[model samples]
Target: MSVAAADPDFATRLNAFDLAALVYEDGIAIDRLMVDFARGLAEAGRRVGGIAQLPPGPATEPGQVDLIDLMTGDIRPLKQRLGPGAASCTLDGSALAAASTGIRRAVAAQVDLVVISKFSKQEIAGGGFRAEFAAAVEAGLPVLTSVKRSQIGGWLAFTGGLGTLLDGRMDILVDWWAETERRRAKTRHRHVS
Candidate 1:
C-alpha cells in the first residue's frame, strides 16, 4: 500500500481532530493497519465499532471480498458475480448497504471508536459508507478510515478539511486514540460542570 509520508504535525493535529483518514495508494497494508488499530482498542477494553474488509482474492477470478463487523464479528460478502463477459465492477451495492448497519449500530451504541474500512470510489460518488461516516461523525465518535491518494480531493471535500490525514502506522493511530480519549474526557468534564 502507498502510505502517506509521515507528517511531523500528525500528533499535534490529532489532539484537535475526531475525524481522520489514512491516505494510501493501494489497500492491502491500509486494511491491515485498520484491523490492528481496532484489535488494539478492543484488547484495551475500548468499545470499537464499524467494519474492516478482507481484500479480494486472486486476479484471475471474480473478486470475493468480505467485510467484518467489528462489534459483532459478523462477515458480510461485498462482491457479486456479474458473469465472465462483464467488464464492469462487480461490487454488490445491496450487500454494502446491509453491511452499513454496523455503522448505524455503532453510532447508537456510542462506541469509543468507529473504524470504517475505506472511503473509496463508492463513497466519493456519494455511496458506500458516506452516510455511515456522516452518522459516526455526527454522533461525536472518533472516526478512522482509509482513502486512496487519488481520492484525496473527494475526501477533503467531504470532510471540509476538518479531518486529519494520517500515515498508515500503528504508532500514529495509537497516538491519535490517546489524544481523542483525552479530548472526550475534557468534554465530559465540562458537561458535568
Candidate 2:
C-alpha cells in the first residue's frame, strides 16, 4: 500500500508481494537513515544486501567516495569530479562496477533484504544500480530505497507499478520491515511444505 493509504496497523496488513520505496523530499537525511536502518536489520540477524552511503568525513572535501556495500561492509568510493568546480561530484563508473559486484554476489547468495541507497538521475537514465535492483526484485527479496519527490514518476515507471511509496519516517520503515519479514517467512514455510 502507498504511504498515503497506509493504516496504523500496516505492519500486520502487508501482503507478501509488496515492494516498497521511500519517498523523500529534499533536505532529508535519507542516506544516513538508510545506513542506520540497514545496521539495525543486520544487528537483528537479517541478511541485508545492496549498499548505503557513508557519512561524509569531517574535512568536507568534494568528490569523496561514500558508498558502502552492506553485504560485505566494504566502504567504496562512488563519486567522481565532473569538472574543475566546487560541486561537480558525479557517479564514478568504476566504483559502481566494484559496488555492483558485491551486490550481485549478495543476491546470488539470497540475502533477506536489499537496501539500495537511492534511485537518482543515473538510474532514471537506465544506468547506476538499475540492474542490481532488478535482480533483487526478480529474486523476490524485500527492496528498500529512497527517491526524491521530483523523481517519483521515473521510479514508478521503473518499478512497473509494483512499488509502495513510504514516507521518510523511521517508524514507518520499521513497520514495513516487519511486514516484509513476516511475508518472507510465510513464503519459506509454504515452499518447505
lDDT of each: 0.79, 0.77
Error of model 2, residue 189, in angstroms: 2.0
- Residue 192 miss distance in model 1 (angstroms): 1.8
Off by over 4 Å in 2: 1-18, 63-65, 81-90
Q: Estimate the overall C-alpha local distance difference test score of candidate 1.
A: 0.79
User: Per-residue lDDT of 5-58 in model 2, one digit per residue for the tens?
Assistant: 233443344343456788888778777788899999899998888888886768
Q: What is the C-alpha lDDT profile of model 1 across 2-108, one tens digit per residue?
A: 11113344434343278988878764488778887898889999999999985544652446678888999888778777777888877888778767898889889
- Give the runs in model 1 whose Cα sits over 4 Å from its true position: 1-16, 55-62, 86-89
Least well predicted 10-residue stretch by lDDT in candidate 1: 1-10
TM-score computed on alpha carbons, candidate 1: 0.83
